[model samples]
Target: MDKALNKTQDRDLIKGFMKGNDRCFEVLLSKYKTKVFTTIYLIVKDRSIAEDLFQEVMIKVVRMIRSGKYNEEGKFLPWVVRIARNLAIDHFRKVQRNPIQHESEDYDIFNTIPRSEGSAEDKIISEENTRYIKELIQQLPDKQREVLIMRSYADLSFKEIASLTDVSINTALGRMRYALLNLKKLAQEKSVPQSYENKVQR
Candidate 1:
């Protein structure tokens, strides 16, 4: 579907739900459930907690739309994603479990390499390089790592990331710049494949 049309449909659905058409809400939920759930799971790293948070996010979305509190204009997905991110963080704070481990065949972070021409890059990965790269990402300072994950893993635009992170767009861009630079340097030090380093540079 065209992006603009998707937003228009979301607006229509929101309006329909506001007018008490519950089915509109179902359509919206069915469209967004997986992405929203994945956002939660990325932070909490527990399926059960992610499922609970997903329900909370849906309830909040429905209530906010009904009460006219959803003031994000036409950007429904990013708005809901922000809610999911926050709730996931709040839950993680409560449980304080092991580090997050993202596992998604479709939304895999490896598919997000800079030179990645979509799925073409997925076939080039080596397990050793993958582990090294993941470790390098973890070594980044918190702010840098956060920006990189949101941009690369969540596929958020810099504008959306800045809005969600409450920073200027330049700041978001800068963090991503530094994150990639750091990763490239780390990769070089670890002597990862030149192909991987090339992807980072790109």
Candidate 2:
């Protein structure tokens, strides 16, 4: 019920913002700023750069909305997420930077995982497993990793992902399939427990 209410409220805010209500835009930013920044940070893995890109993303989103080019049929968060992802990817392409490395020491990857209801031992074990899986994800080919990250972290549908990547739906699906297969293969090679393997798929 709260989720539904929040969605409705977000839509109303967008409507108001489109009609030139500046306060509505502020509310919208307050609601999604953390989520948007986090999504970009996950992909880019740099705090300062992510912050700069986040501002650029918001500027672009506002421009699109004001220009009446933003697609209202889609949910706003996913739309913004797609924009941020595209901008980050474009930055990387322009700079020809090396792909994101899984720097476990540099950042606490475990913080990204949700804390499940369990004992301390179970939670620790889960975090360890999640970290291991994320490391494996980072090892995937760029396309596969991007698809998996969008699907898993951004909560985007395969169709949306296809559109974002400028690929056909089948290609997006294939990348996700390959990503899972590669993860599973890595898990086996690493001797990860079967239960953790199932969790990775989930």
Candidate 3:
């Protein structure tokens, strides 16, 4: 069965990775790095923070694997995700205490999308819709919002999300499901049209 084969392959990859098979490790990185980074990005909503956290996650993963601390009994992706989530949480906590916001405001991912000149009505509609959705996302419970942004914007898989957020896959799924439900609720309350929903779902 595909499930059994996947398990076997994971085990082999872990073993190979532990043995300093750099290529095998690269394979693992290639498979999960973008998903992990995107998940982190969604949480922090800052490109620099996301990039730093992503690198930290990989470094921690490499260390754990090299130190033989990585257990193979469970899925690999989830474990790495947990690491990423923990790191992000720690980073945020540190920021809250020190309150030293990153200096590069212009580089924040959640701010300002590049756009070209368009008809006045089109621009107004687009900007209003964007503002509404952004507000809606900000209102979601932290967990649901985190999952939705990561999956919807950053394109992380549920498995990767679970790993990064330190939740079970089912929990990740639940958060995403509730996030969408709440998003729908917000859109309806704002009288967002079906056309907007269609675009968002894409």
Candidates' C-alpha lDDT: 0.74, 0.80, 0.76
How well is each residue in 95-196 modelled by candidate 3, as lDDT tens digits?
988886653855645354555489887776777676677667877889899888667755568887787678999999999999988988887777674558
Error of 1 at 175 (Å): 1.2
lDDT order, best first, reads 2, 3, 1
Point out the worst 10-residue segment of candidate 2 by lDDT.
1-10
Model 1 Cα lDDT, one tens digit per residue, 95-173: 5665555445455444433453545455455644665666788778877877887776666789999988899999999
Instruction: For residues 32-144, write the lDDT of model 2, one tens digit per residue.
Output: 88778767876776666777899999999999998998887889889999899889979789667665543446665455546999999888777777667756776788899
> Clashes in candidate 1: how many?
0
Q: What clash count goes with each model? A: 0, 0, 3
Could you tell me which residue pairs clash in candidate 1?
none
Q: Compare the candidates by lDDT and give the number of the best one.
A: 2
Better model by TM-score: candidate 1 vs candidate 2:
2
